[model samples]
Target chain A: MNCRQARDLMSAYLDAALSPSLRQDFEEHLQECPACTAELGSLAEVVSLVRSLPEKPVPDGFHQLVMTAVAAAHPAPRAAKVPLWARFDFSRFGRVAWAAAALVIFFGLGLAAGRYLFPASAGSTAYVPPSVTAKPASYDATVATGGNTVTDTVAGIGRQVAYSAKMDLQVQDVRAAAAAVSSLAEQNGGYVEESKITTGWFGRVSAHVKLRVPQAKFQATVDQVGAQGKVISKEITAEDITASYVDVTSKLIALQTQEQQLLDLLRQTTSVDDIVKIQKELEDVRAQIEAIKAAIQNYDSLVAYSAVEVNLSRPLFPWLSVVWPGLGGP
Target chain B: MGPQSPENREALLVQRCQSGDLEAFGELIAPYEKKVYNLAYRMSRDAEEAKDLAQEAFVKAYLALPGFRGEASFATWLFRIVANVCTDALRKRRQQEVVSLGRQVETSDGEVMLELPDAGAGPSDVLEDLERQHAVERAVRSLPAEFRLVVVLRDIHGYSYEEIASIAGVNIGTVKSRLNRARQRLRELLQDGELFEPHNVYKTRAPSKGGAGR
Candidate 1:
């Protein structure tokens, strides 16, 4: 083997990738050639040094940091239990219960729409039964009271409903419209959640406000806000979450009960080991209770206060300038 | 409670992670964090960049866990993600110059001194070793991205050509050629500093039959 051949085969030789005959020839060449031998040695040292470079220790809390980031990106789904109604074997009820439930839902939605569209006129029919309205009355009571019969309530045990409305308006001034929305929400025992005002490409001002108004004032608030400007487009949505709400509420109650039991055990336990184990379990149960409570609270608030998203924009006058030169000025 | 095999443990952890257990994913990645960090550090030669790369790799792995089919070992899959992330970062940074080893600036007195460490600060032996390591690191950093990756994988991380090929998404022949060229370039850089000399070359004994190649 010549020096060139030895140099070409150097990495292969070091890796032991050369065949027997080729390896023999390479070794023979290495025996005769000091330059090839020295070159191979230097290369080997470099490779060895590279391999021996210390492994950099990962920073402290790296796992926690990674987990924190991952959690932020993909939050853990709520561990709410499936509601009894949702898990019910509806097949045994045949199509009668399903048809009756659907009819009640449809009637309930129509009554809700009537109350929203004509608040004064729809009051008599939309009024809740005194018995149901008197029970620990909260957001869920509002849904049950919305012209739904006792039979409807029984069928809708796991049902939750959230209302939201979006309105696009052409206003003389966006700031004024935004102020009116804030005032409307405040007057109705609600509040403005978020508001943003921006000037677009044509220097036309636009304002966006997210309002949370009591379900009772949802239609009124929409109407009041819509009056601020020329109505461009309006969309109202009602999402039924009775199943999810029931599931979350039930889970919260169960977790809270478990937490209380663990707390009781923690107090009565005499053994140190048992105390420690009970305490750990209590802590876990408490955490679950807190999460479930938060979910329930979220559902309650959403059902109690409907979300009103309003977009108000000032009209542009580019056409005025084109038709009559110098007629329009910023 | 009883000692479990690594494969079974890893499979269980992966299952948990796929089912949305973040804590399980954290445990699954504990063993490979240092290796992944080192890989990133060797690629970027910047501690902060390596941290970012390592974090991104883990996050991507976590997000993509549901799609992992166990076709490859978890380590292989993770390393592949790290390699791709590093490659993207290097590509984005391509417009910027690679860090030069001995950057020099003209002084007020027109004395062009090498921009290096002060020689009088430390013990000679310790300083020499540090300087040698620093030089090697810089030389590795200065290599083209492809060559640097192949060299780091094969020589430093001790991956076989086939593994490197899979990680790099290239054929084995490409891995072999890139590794050879990278080693040659490293030798040239060491020679330029007079750190590598032809004399005192030691020959290791050839491996016995059946133990030669990976």
Candidate 2:
């Protein structure tokens, strides 16, 4: 091999990447040419020095810093299941755009807050100011309210929203908090859907209760339960199911109409085969109508009764409590 | 009971992280933080920049963890993210003027010399080794970003050609060529320092009587 060829293969030779035959030829050339041998040795030494370079020590509290940043970037949700809507792609907009949009939403909601605050007046028709109604024709006002349902002219009855809340409470007495929550739910014509209480070693107590309360009394019940203890955290979510609700309700209506038409045809039909065919289609439509009705019923229940999850905890040793000293007294 | 294997532990942690457990993600990254920091330090040659790059890579990895399918080991996947992050940082840094290490230093007599770090009070052999190591480091740092990456992955980290190709998003042939060119450049740079000039045994010898002999 010429010096040029030997030089090209030197790195591969060092890496043991060359084929046996090529390696033999390269080794022979290296023995014959001291220049290539010395160059290879120098390369080897350089590689060795680089590999031996001491690793730079990581700065102290790196793990803590990383965890802090991670927590800030993604706060751990109390509920294990993250809502689908919460994961929406808000990253497509720049920060400035998001801020501007948020400002608009805040002012718009402030104007509409009075209407939403009084549940008794929810059925009353409120006048939408001309300025608010004068949006451009191209603008999709239905989408502005979120959900896919176009509620422009439809009655408010079609607008079904499910409300849920989660609250963490540091209570002086877990049992007392649990009883208060259950009593609040009962007072609102509701009940506890699920409850878990654990008393660990040293008499430390914690309770988790999932309460279902009347939608009209959701806020009142939450406030009363929250007043039972010091709330450490709270989250409230409203999910509009108007699109799915409207879709299923309309489908059920259409299927019912079809079923009636089939029944009329069944009465007039004389041939056995025609009767059988109509009856088969009638059965299918009836099944679909039943399924849609079940879905609407589910939505109705979810809308009628909101879910509230409350977590209450107390320290194991009363004297060990640093933050809640007054509550620490046995 | 026996301890859980790393693979099982990693899988469990990944599952928990997917479920929005940040603590589990922290545990998952504990073993790789140092490796990642070292890689970042080598790439940027700035400690502060390395920390930023490492932190950014971890944050990105966490956000993208939901989409991770575990097809490759987490380390390989994380290395790919680190490489991309470092590349972007270098590109941004390139927009500003960057002083190359070991460039010419002028003395009072206007004589040019290679810029080097101050040699601390050490024995001669130790000082010599330190100087040579610094020269080699500067040479590696002076290489083009692409060549420098491949060389670091291959020679320093001791990754296989295929693994380098995967992390670098290049084919094996590209990796091999880049590594070869990088080593050749390093040799040239070191020769200017006379670190390897004395070892070039054939430089004083005459040409062979038979040229290109088989």
Candidate 3:
């Protein structure tokens, strides 16, 4: 075995990637040639040093940048799930491009915001615009989960009752379910008052959606949403404000009657003192009537729509969102 | 319980990504993101270009995912894309510049014969392993692209010869020959540095016809 042959076998020999007989011949050549053996050592040293080179981390937020570039290039995976972005076919909108437009709008907000912003386009159409919704509003317990209230079964059969519910749900994917819940709200002639996915301490992520579906479909919406994930717990409460409503109405009538009487008394009074006293009493009575009217109106809307606060959470795994790659849905 | 093993999860992610689940693609390649970026860095010395090339490789993988018929492991397939992307990019960059394949340095004036590091510094501080590794990196980076590919893939990245062949789209013999030659070139470059004066230097002078001054 010559020095030339020994040099050829050096790397494979270092890797132990050589045939046994061939390795023996190379080893024999190395034993005879100090120059070739030293050559082999230096080659191994170079290989080792290259192997030990420090790794460079991709720049911070690099993952997000890559995702943004990808989203910009392709239609977001969820764009198909959102019918409006499809119908608008923002494809014609050119640069508005794909579902990734949402990412650009809410960059760093994560997929939860993506799901939220998508269905919100639908919510605006179906949701009760605050302008058109009755004024002097206080009570709209969009929380009622369609469960027949105790008022429905009791002696107050035609009762004006406000139903509100709270539900805890566990889902595999919070953002997807939140989107589905928002869509369901729109389908049921309701609006998502609040849909947010937040990352909490220890990198835990959970979503909460507030839906205001019509009382008629309140139960149906709850059932549909519960079907998306395991229902951790549910609580429904009904406030039969029928008595308060009726009492307020009767007081309103009495106050109006007092105001009319004061008006007539003012017409009869000849002295300025008598007229001034009656005018002040009439104003006070009119204010009472207006207050009662506003209370009754609030009761009417609250009774018509139930409020359901759907608290959707995912099972906490130490390795979930922070570690799992694709869970950051499209 | 960890219901799905890593392999099973990756297979499912690849399928989902193929069907246009961007999230699945992200998950599928999460482990390889840094690896691919480093692979790009190995191909091109420019950090920014490496980042762009790495990102481009992923986007290309995503677009072509539906056709990824599981012939190679997703990693092998993905890495091959990175190599092709980086090599093509490096080739373009190389062409636009005055191609220098010898001990040469760029200056405002033009190409200058490479300056050897101060041999007095020596390799006495092996604990300065980062410095030592970086020195080796300079040697590796100076190698010809063809040689650099197999060397980086095999030595630095620790890919088996068969995998290197598959990734480089070459047969095993080509991989071995290139890797061996690449290493020889690397040793010559290293020996030309800190420790000694051209201990194993081969007379490598790029033909003067291409770059007149060099």
Candidate 4:
């Protein structure tokens, strides 16, 4: 081989990468060429020197550190099951926004307090004056002198006892049951004092009834009304109005007496100024007597009857929507 | 084991180390670290860089042990890694063109050249001359990047052509060719007039580039 060709093949030969025949040819060339042989020797020495260098030791904690990193990358399996709210860091901007919303709600409620919750004081209170000014107070006499009054009229009614109850029912037909309850009140010698009914699709049906049953048949009336449906909950309350009835009755009598006196004064007065004053006084006393009579009637109605509130609902059976996979073909 | 039975002990250590025993791994490295470090030092020409490369190789080998597959001997694999790391360091240094971390001193007569600061110095003093050291360092630094890699891997690091090929990911033929070209360049560096005057005289006497008298 020429020098250039030999030089090119020299590296492969030194590496023992040549075939047997090729290696033989290289050996023959080397034997005939001292310069090439010398060059090969120098290259061999270089390879030897490089191969003789020392090996270094690995640094400490390498395995532990790598394992620690791996463990962090793949955490314990239980971490996936934690709820998002608890897992999320509340220290972030989301937490700040949440606090801001809460602050706004509290601040709004604090501002609304003055309008809705202010208690009146004599000077601090702002009362709206009427369009027509109030007339000044006046006096009158000689209308009734000493006779039957409003208080004597209210005291003539007998004493009464009150009863109330709250009942929760589950009925298939709320309207039918409510009608049946009203019919039962009439049959038991009672009248409907107050009655109301409200209906809607969202399972919230309720009826309120204040029925005055004859005092002797109160228990029987309650029992017959309760046979309507399954009762989920119940509450009953009873009170006697004997003392309040008597006191209101006597006060009503006193106001009627004053009213009769003012009416007699009006009849006796001849001058226009005296007559106008007497008529105003008479009207005021009569209005007070009317108020007392209305109060006594309200108390008598409450004491003689029982108010019942029935909360009703239709049964709802919950079901999950089932989507059958590929069952129906069109 | 007794000193006379060192070969048997070494074989036993190799066996145990291959079986994944950490104590055996430590024993295997203890006797070889210094040799590996020196090889790395010559190739990288920096004590610190060599040490780091050597350590990196050991760590790499340890991490790769589980997948070693035992295709070649463990020592051979380790040497391949060390050569690779040193080559990588050299390549990085070359890209940045760093000079004089540490290099040898050679004389014009093809001998290592060192100069003594004082005329009348001790025997060790002559071996530690700064001017001669600088000259040798410049000669090595002046080599082309490709030639330098082959020379450092083969000559300074003492890697076999096959090991160099494995580490360098080249065929053995390429390694040898590169080494030859590197040697030619190194010889030229040693012979250059600027390097040493006596080296010029030896250069004329030395055989030319071609085969002898062919």
**Candidate No. with top lDDT:** 2
**iRMSD for every model:** 1.3, 1.4, 1.4, 6.8
Write down the DockQ of candidate 4: 0.09
Please report the TM-score between candidate 1 and the true structure.
0.51
What is the per-residue lDDT of model 1 for residues B1-214, given as tens digits with 9 covering 90 to 100? 4449898899899999989876688789999988898899999958768988888988999989989999988888889999999988886786575444566544444633234322121236676678678777877886667888999988778898888998999998888777876786677666655555322111112233236764
Better of 1 and 4 by DockQ: 1
Query: Cα lDDT for residue A157, model 2?
Result: 41
Least accurate 10 contiguous residues by lDDT in model 1 chain B: B197-206
Q: Give the Å shift of residue B62 in candidate 4.
A: 2.7
Cα lDDT tens digits, model 1, A179-255, are 88778889988999999999889787889899998887787787788778766667777777676665545444555
- Runs in model 3 lying further than 4 Å from the true structure: A75-330, B1-3, B99-131, B196-214
* Residues B1-214 of candidate 4: C-alpha lDDT, one tens digit per residue: 6765865675676666455554465666666666566656656656546655666767666555656655766566666777677777777876685444334356444743223211111235344334344444444545544566666666555667777777666787677777776665554454342333433433554465334765
Higher-scoring candidate on lDDT, 3 or 4: 3
Interface RMSD, prediction 3:
1.4
Model 1 clash pairs are: A158-A242, A158-A243, A159-A242, A160-A241, A160-A242
State the lDDT of candidate 3 residue by residue for A156-185, as single tens digits: 224567777788777878888888888998
Off by over 4 Å in 1: A75-330, B1-3, B102-123, B197-214
lDDT of each: 0.72, 0.73, 0.70, 0.57
Shift in Å, residue B116, candidate 3:
5.8
lDDT of 1: 0.72
lDDT of 2 by residue, A243-318 (tens): 6565555555556567778999999999999998788777766665655556667777777788899998874454
